[model samples]
Target chain A: MKRNSIIVVLLALVCSLSLVFLSGCATDQTVKSNTIKGDANISTMETAKSKAESVALEEDTLKEAALKAKREQERLMAEAAAFKEKDIHFDFDRYDLTSDARKILGEIASWLSKQNGWEITIQGHCDNRGTGEYNLALGERRAETAKSYLMSLGIAEGRIDTISYGEEMPLDPANNEVAWAKNRRDHFLVVSKK
Target chain B: MRKIIALLIFSVVFWCSSAACGKVYIDINSPAFQKFPLAIPEFKDLGNMKPGENLSAWFADQLSSTLKITGFFKMISQDAFLEDQSRAGITVEEIDFSNWSSIGSDFLVKGGFSYDGKNLAVEFRLFDAIEGKLITGKKYWGKSEDKKAMVLKFADETLLALTGKGGVFDTKIAFVGKEGSSSEIYTINFDGSDPVKVTTYKSLSLSPQWSQDGAKIAFTSYKAGNPDCYVIDVASGTTQKISSFRGLNLPASWSLDGKKILMVLSKDGNEDIYIKHLDSGSLQRLTNDRAIDVSPTWSTDGKKIAFVSNRSGSPQIFVMDSEGKNVRRLTFEGSYNSSPCWSPDGTKIAYEGSSNGCFQIFSVGEDGNNLMQLTFEEGGGESPSWSPDGRYLVFSSKKNDREMVCIINANGSDLRVLPDIKGVKSSHSPSWSQHLNLY
Candidate 1:
């Protein structure tokens, strides 16, 4: 029984060694080319992905700066637009400006100084107190007086135009004193802006 | 003193024209005139006239209406006549003055008409009813279709016999009539008989001043979108622009000889009066005041021009020589006065002045004395136009919130709304024409 056991152990050791050696040889010949090609493809894919990410980040930064500049310009334009909303008033049967008119005109002059490439038209009006023909002339004088005042300021004369509406286009169509006060005025209209 | 001499001459002529003159029915110089009671019998239709459509009645009706328009005669009805006369009895021998005198008629008119298909013959006689004598007689021959002309001629002759001057019943009035939102130029007879639209511009028009000969009208219109002055021939409706100077081109007055037109032009950036010669198109600037000067009117002799100016801080009447020399302000009392029209006789100027915020018509002597108020009523009166005879004034009146054309006697009596105009409720800026005498 002892002699049979020794022989079996030797046979087992020999079979194990033969199997290990055969498997090692097969791995060396067939798996060598595929593993190196696979490693090269993975490294090239990683470099291309990193370069694309870097270009996308740089474009986002430039877009952000351009948006900031456009927003600033719009804010300045909105401020200059506010000066066109007010009108100058006059007294009854008179083309001379009241104190209130001069105050309003000064504000307009300051705002116009900051704006470039802007032109305005000044329309002179009158209350229904005199003859139509005479009122026309009176209204013209009123507009010219206003233009002269603007010229005394830094505003350019060529940027202003004048027209007289007489009593035809009244701001207030009533014949009473309160309405006439409102109707006798110099109205401003923006003709062009760049 | 000169007026008294004129009355004396009129009285002598009146007494010499009639055989038995005693008292005058109407005193021409009186402030409030007394209307004469005048009798007009039916016009007799002679043979072959056929009297179609009551032709005889039409003739008598026209004559009576024309006489009443003068505002000097009160027509006595036919029912009040003492005797009925036929065409054969139109002679002096057949008319018995006592018959008319009994009816309180100071004057009588008898006429006859015969129309023979193509031609018409009309005979009329004016008589001083209490004198038993014929003052004047006339015979007219015209086409049968021209019966209206014959009737108007006879009426003119009757007025000439009584007043030593023909009536203005043949005259016309040109005014601004509103159509929709725009105003147009219109012409109507003196008694408001026929209203004819002279302009179809369908735009704002104003200040329609008739030429002295009544052949054309000068007005301002906005057809070309500017207040431009235009002259239109009344007969042919042909229009020609006289002034289109980039601004207000308002007509002020036409010269008495029809040789020139004075207008207000604002082309030089200010209002100034300008005279434009019709034949040569030459323009002359008359005033250079920096203040407003407008609405120029010429005197009877055409040697002077009166205009409205605000040089004294308010609009007032100013008179200057024809060449713009010798400038004199004529009004000192009012803060506002406009529309100064010189009287045809060169003795007075009628204008509109505001009193207590009510505009009324006033007349002042040429030398700025004898200021007389011609109208007083609710609303206000403006644009006073004088008759050619200087006996009546027609103006625009605003009463009851409606605009109306009114005619008042020069003495401020007999104020009445001009009759037969449609939609006169909004009419303004009346301009009376010279005696047309179209017939």
Candidate 2:
């Protein structure tokens, strides 16, 4: 039974390594495949971008956009929904992502691999201790670490931007170790290319 | 003859306890009292004198100045001396105290110097001519140029031994002066005389602060293309780089013990205060604020630091432990309270604040009590440095794009701008001198 457990552990590591490699290898394939749908995607994305501007946005009398508006909305919602579940969390008080964090980030790398116009921003954060001067730096470093890993997974440098907010913004308000662990993370913010 | 000798002993005893020189300082508020008058004789040169060197005269002048500045002494003229400067068989070796008692001279000052071309030394003897016993004897050593500095040191030591307070003749002032687009370091006398340019090369340097012992000065320089901290030996002119970080290196303070310097750096993408050890290049980050933290000044005991931070929507003064713990905001009366310089006595902190829509110098108690305004002009004021005696402060004010140096009393009296000497560009960042051991 111990021998079986050893084989299972090896199998799990191999699966993780393959997942990393596959996520990386799929970018070239996706880009080439994405080119076939480029013209239609641009037109549909433009229509969706305008309608998604705001609820008060006036109608531009976009004859073509009006016709494709409903399908464009569906495409964007599907695209944004695909990334909602991918949260890149980290170990307590550190910027390096955990094993579970790597798994989630691998899914993000795969999602980014399926597109060409992604301009993702990684905002690093930290649990506060010193003066405001230091936390800003810690936040930036955390964000850069995540961006670098994404780049190593075949995400182009030009498509990734990093900024540190230090301990300014937090999704969790509890002032405890668990909350700090959750706050010390790189939250992905996607800005589509012009 | 017995009556004359008794009067002479009384005068000698009076001079022994009075000023080193003729000038004296008296507060108008203090009750007026009769001063003990004294005669200053041209010191007799007992040893072979070098050409162009008057060791006796220098000693006399130094002694006179020390005594005079203290609000005592009605010093008799050097011409009234019963002797001459020429050591040509002078009667100094055969002086009698009874003669001075008859002349109504309450006290007498006399000394001499000896130089063997290879070794320069000064020997002085202070006598209570009335009691007929020597009060104090001092000897000093230095080169011709350092003779004055050494004599001042000796005088200061002797004065402290007598009065229990240090002398002020040997202290120096470290100030920042800009030339064209760049700034340089300079030092001057405590009375703001004889400005000596310390930093000749142009690299936009400012904030010249002395170590606790006044041997080394640390300031920020951009010569290496980024702001980094550098220390310069005042006597040797040797320079050493302290912090070579990637960006934003503004040295803000020195540790109370002068073992480390506190500075701001942006190597980690945020400006934070870092303490750099002088002996070892080891550094410790003290602040992690998401906002800008710059300008750190140490407390007297080295346990805590007062610094400026913009984390509270606007810049304000804050205090933290030496290890960067227990952060607390210290100012709420101003929109901006920065450039905090702690007084030597550690009772108050003089800083620049912009509460009245213009930056002005202000002082507040360390526990955040008794807010006092020190300066208020059309342009504004900043960079307050306390003198060694904690009686005076030197600061800088904005004129146009440049600044000018100004010195004021600790309680905010006698506010005046330093004279615009040649080669003075923009003047800012003043550090006052500690009392020199000038005797």
Candidate 3:
């Protein structure tokens, strides 16, 4: 009976020690889960902040693209208007370029330089004073003179084409010096743009 | 007395025989030539069926007008005719020669027609009023719609008998008719009748030249946004692009054999004349000058080419061989000479030269000897195209501020504006076609 009492006391003491160890493990697990939860909350907050920043960045990129496209459109339109702004005139039955004509052609060359992927056509016209056959040749000469001048000014030859109207299509149909001067001209047109 | 009468009769017989032996009745080349007086009585209605359409008066009027347009015949007034219209005869055996000869009729035309509303048979006879001999006779069978054609055929025969050359009655003149900003090719009869629209390309089409066979017309058009050379089949109205070189593709003339076309091209950096072979599609550049070279015309013999060039510090005509060699300058008197046209005989070249601040038609011998100015009108003449017989020229001129097409004799006489083409503001660039074989 004395030995039985001693064994029971030892068993109770061992059971108390095991219960303390299990409680310590459960406290460690609870501490780990709480730490994990806190870390998750921080991660969620960081994710939200990054998402907001990304949305704002995307909007900024889209606005910038729209602004760039608008600018490109405006530039193209301006270039087109400038390219067709004026026509160079010639004297009676003459194909030689004058000083004013040269200046205008120089301006045309500059506009063409900016307009890559575009093509131009130079329509040569003449007054009704000369014969149609001769005027046809004269118109061609005027167009060629302008084209040659433009090519000399660094414009590509392939980008330029020419046609002669030969007094057939006149800007002014009146029979006077003013109308004739206006009719004898080199008109520029934008044939294509890509 | 007997011997003298026999001698006179022998001489008269000789003269009549000579007149019948292909002797031309009219010498039109004479500078002092006078218009031949002609008379035509009302045609006889030989039809046994019911009378129709006043065919007698219509035939007489048609013949008179057709002959008068040649500037060769002076029609005698029907009121002055002594022959009774109701009993007049068409056959030489049944006519009184004194009636025609006394009325100053050197030639007389008698016509008779039988019409059944669906078909018509007509007979015509040309007689020398003095000798009362039938010079030519023709009988035609056709429908009522062929009345004009039959009259034209008889007129051509009469002209052939008198002038030793056929009339251009069946030919057409191709010209550029302009309205607003567009110009198109239009064709009209030689007498300015039956105006036909040839091209419907509502763009600038210029320099129309007829093929030798009259089956096609080659011209330049801006319809494709470039001056491209196109040949249109006249009958079918189908167009084909023959040359579309990057630069000026103006067709000027076709070869005599219809195997080649002469065109002005600027593909080699400037305007130059080049001949394109129709069969091989091979191009042979005939001119290589830095100056403007254009308006090429092929000679009838196909041995030479005449073109206009501004190489001598002014525009002038130039002649070269078919192979593009032996270039010689022509037209030294003018500062501006262009639109070189070779005569059908290849003996003379006609062009427009600037004179007195306006262009006038001028012609020079192929050897450059006879440089004659053919026009001195206030508005001036340009684009001289030769008739098929080489006896007349057709050109464009401005009269009363309106552009009109005019025809003139080769001797620079009888200049008259063709009747106006209706509904067109102006007409220019007239190109005369060869005699079309319509029969």
Best TM-score goes to which candidate? Answer: 3
DockQ for the candidates, in order: 0.12, 0.01, 0.39
Q: Write the per-residue lDDT of candidate 3 for residues B1-439, one digit (tens) a residue.
A: 0011111011121122323577897699898899989998888888753544678889999999989888898999998999886876877778998999998998999988886665677888888999987888777777666778888888987888888777888788898888767888988888878888899888888888999877789998989988899999988899989998877899999887888999898888788989999899999988888998999999999999999888988888999999999999978996888898999999999899989778899999999999999988887898999988888899988764357889988888878787776667778898899878754
- Candidate 3 lDDT, tens digit per residue, A30-68? 999999999999999999999999999998898888899
lDDT of 1 at B303: 93
Higher-scoring candidate on DockQ, 1 or 2: 1
Q: Which ten residues in a row have the lowest lDDT in candidate 1 chain B?
A: B1-10
Which regions in candidate 1 have their CA more than 4 angstroms from the true location? A1-194, B1-27, B77-79, B82-88, B419-425
- The true-versus-predicted C-alpha distance at residue B124 of model 3, in Å, is 1.8
Could you list the iRMS of every candidate? 3.5, 13.0, 1.9
What does candidate 2 score on TM?
A: 0.53
lDDT of model 3 at residue B203? 86
Per-residue alpha-carbon lDDT of model 1 for A1-194, expressed as tens digits? 89789778878777777766777777775577667887788888888888788777767776777677566556655654555457788875577778888887787677667665666777778875555455666777788778888879888988877766666566655546787788788888754465
Which digits, one per residue and each the tens of the lDDT, describe model 1 over residues B1-439? 0011111011222223522333233465486657877888888776676544557777788889877877778899988887856423877777778889998998888888776676677777778888777776777766666666666766776666676566787788888776545778888887777788899877778778999998889998878876788999998999999999866788878887898999888888778999999899989999998888888899999999988988998889999999999999999887888889999999999998888777788999999999988888675677888999888898887644345678887887777776635643356688999987667
Tens digits of per-residue lDDT for model 2, B1-439: 0011111011232233334542232332133543335555656665666887766666678767655543334566766655433532223345676656556555555555667775565555555556544445555554556555555554554444344454555677788776765668898776455688877777667668788777788887767755567899876889988877765566667775778898877777666888988788888999997776878888877788999887886668998888999999989986667778888888888888875456788898889998988887765777788877666678877665456788765666556677675877567678775543332
DockQ, ranked from best to worst:
3, 1, 2
